[model samples]
Target: MKLKFLFFAISFLTAIHVFSQNTYVFLGSYNKNKEAESIQVFQLDTLNGKLTKITAAKNVINPSYLTVSPNGKYVYACTETKTPNDGNVSSFEFNPENKSLTFLNKQKSGGENPVYVSVHKSGKWLVNANYTEGSVSVHPLLENGKIDSLAQNFQYSDGSINKERQTRSHVHSAVFSPQFDYLFLPDLGADKIRCYGFDETKKQPLTETKNPFTKTDLEAGPRHFTFHPNQKFGYCIEEMAGAISVYQYENGALQKIQRINTHSDKIKEGFESSDIHISPDGKFLYATNRGKENNIAIFSIDENGLLTNIGYQSTLGKHPRIFALDESGKFLIATNVISGNVIVFKRNQITGLLKKVGKEVKMENVSCVQIKKI
Candidate 1:
């Protein structure tokens, strides 16, 4: 009787461990050909930082970027990119039981080269930034998970100092404030971070804020923006300038606090800094740099919301356009677009450093990586 009771207790604990591991990694890629998989889902092994392929969404065209709905029931992607005026935002219904994604519907993205898509926390609004057209499109999401037609389209007609890349407004990303009350658009070509007031209750949910925009350094082409978990600070990764602009946040307004370089002094030219993200604990921040300098810059966040450079980790691949930290902040996965691979790194929570682990996934032109516990 004693032996049987011990066996039952061990089995119960093992079952709980298996059931608690629910994190998933979603990867988006540029589908150069029809036969290629544009979006793939993998189940992450939390113990070893290994990713196992679960499924892939079918018939997705150039899903270069992806965002999962707040409820984890749906996913949306920027599709048909680089297709002239045919860029689109596609929606998919995610079935966790079967671990599959079903195509729902798509809507015209309102501009060209739709590169980034973000869903509001309320799950009622969706926004996408057009990289080539330098515009933003707002859409209302239906209760059934389909995206409605465009509700509002805001276009920018300004350029910065760089005559080549900053010839016109190139909005790289659209990010929502932690409170979900505001939307921030980082325009790489305009050298400005545009702000908009977001109201979920309105038919047209986005309106220009009183302080409409914050200007960065002349050639600091801001690409991606992320807010700290504390909600008091925001960071923008500037692609052209290869620096991160830190700002103090309050009520939809940002005050520049610091501007730090993402690379060492020796590496100056060809700076293509990309993604930026804060850890779940809000203790550290990471930014990825592409181009000739391919690495993830690490920084420690102080109580006053400023960053101190800690160390840098090599991504072990080329052109890491995007990377994501797991919900637990235990693992980070980076997608190397040019090298056609995805590498996983085990994050040291105490020191906030990363060590590469597990075999890399050989994929072609993967542009984005996002992780969620569903």
Candidate 2:
């Protein structure tokens, strides 16, 4: 009887592993002058948190930021450029059958140094944010998974308190609201979160909303923004100040509710916050901080959307530019740009803590990480 019971338990666990969906992860790197493949694809074993290389997408110039379509059939990247008004965005067809990417076409990004790109939920519009010139560009997605000409290009002129980093407007990210009715442009150099109404049904998809925009602290340098799963609150991670600002969002407007630091007071100087994300369950939030304190700050979100600091974990590498959690919320991957390595961590689901899984991949200046079920 005991032998039969043990056999049944092993069979049950094996069935669960076989039924789980296979996960695919894409890594983007800062490949200057096309020295290496800009994007690399890997397969992640959900049961054991193992990452195996699958393939790579080559010849993409500085494809620093990547976003997939709603259907996951296409992939888009921001081709970070140096020349003013010369940045471009590229589109690729993702072949799931063989796990390969084929280049489709590219479009001008309106401004230089395109740092961020996001696809609209409808999969009809692609929004890009240019950092060097502080501009936002919108493009229509063609039916063939390519990009149309620039639909709108809005330039910002204001500068904030930080003279070195905020000499002029520096639009960092373009994120859509929960319902897709509004878009938020976080400007690091202007100290403002610009809001706009989106209507893809019209000739022009984006228009300035009635509320216009909202302001952050004098030198907050709002870099990235994320909305809660409940859609009642929003959070902005400040790049220059190493802080997270909470807001009550409604009808394209933001009301600042609370602000919390991503790092402790002991490490006062040289704080450069990079990215922020919420867990799949929406109970936990994570933000990355660079500089002397190279770690990820973890927090728990209360019922009212307020945050309570929990703990911090070392990234096991330098300059963790960005990190993302898998769909199952079982694993987390971080791209260490300065160290040129990608590290994976196993997540404790109930306690919301991270443990290094002893897996790392060496690449050239890794910058971004994206995981999707294939």
Candidate 3:
């Protein structure tokens, strides 16, 4: 009887360990064919970096980007991308028990080609950046995970040095500050990082801060902005120049502190840097470069929030548009848009490097990858 009780205790502990190592990976893709699936859900094995398909959500056209709510109960996606004068932001209920997504409702995005969406930590607000129409929209999230109509809209008309790519304002990403009191929008075309104060209690929660914008270098084309884990610094990846601009962040204002190139000296032209993410422990940073240089640049952060480029890892696929690290910080997954595949990597926590692992998941034109622990 004693031995049987001991075995039962050990088995219970083992079951809990296995359940803790599972995470959900969400992939958003561009539906070139109208009947194709737009969003997919996969179960990621955090222990080995393996992915098993759970299900896919269809009927939404061009769900290019996705973001999960703070509670992990809902997912929001930007749909109908590149549709002239018509773009929408859709919401879905995420059921972790069954591992499926149910379509809730969608609202007009207030502009064309909504490329990015971010939810506030309170799960009360949702904001999106419109790439083609050069606008920003704010929405109130209902209690049932439905998105309210657009509460506020802002438009910008500005251009930078690049005549072709920077001819007009192209807001690429909308990110919330660590404190959840501000929102930052990285404008690729205007070469500026726009800031706004956020107050969740009010009807219109977005207000202009004292220092509204931080200007970038000429032709830099800032694409994505990510805050450091310590909340003392922020990093922006430039799409056109293949560089990262580091900033000292305080109360919605950004002061540039360091500027670093993400590529080697041998590569000269065709730099299309896409995504930026920092490790959970605040020790390392990683950025993805597309176009001619298809690699992920690895960097180490110091005590003063400065980045020192350590090395680069080939993505093993072409056109890595976005990559995400799981909540455990042990697995990193990247989506190759043009290559039509998803690659998983084993992350080294101490050295801050990535090793390709597991089999590649095939999904045509996958644009964004996000992981959430449920």
TM-score of each model, paired residue for residue: 0.94, 0.93, 0.94
Most lDDT-accurate candidate: 1
Give the alpha carbon lDDT tens digit for every residue of 1-374 in model 3.
Answer: 99999999999999997766558999999885767878999998776788999888988899999999988899999999888888999999988778689999999998999999999999999999999978899999999999998899999999888898888999999999999998999999899999899999999999989978899998999999999988999999998889999999888888899999998778898778899999999999999988888999999999899999999999888999989998778988999998899999999999999999889999999999999987
Candidate 3 backbone clash number: 0
lDDT of 3 at 122: 92
Clashes of 1: 0
Lowest lDDT 10-residue stretch of candidate 3: 14-23
Ranked by lDDT, the better of candidates 2 and 3 is 3
Q: Which pairs clash in the backbone of model 2? A: none
List residue ranges in candidate 1 displaced over 4 A.
1-21
Query: Which is the better candidate, 1 or 3, if ranked by lDDT?
Result: 1
TM-score for candidate 1, please give it.
0.94
Candidate 2 lands at a TM-score of 0.93
Model 1 over residues 1-374: C-alpha lDDT tens digits?
A: 99999999999999997687588889999886777778899988889988899888767789999999988889999999988768999999887679898889999999999999999998999999999989999999999999999999999989998989999999999999999999999999999999999999999989878989999999999999999999999999999999999999999999999999998778969878999999999999999988888899999999998999999998988999989998889999999998989999999999999999988998889989889887
lDDT of 1 at 317: 88
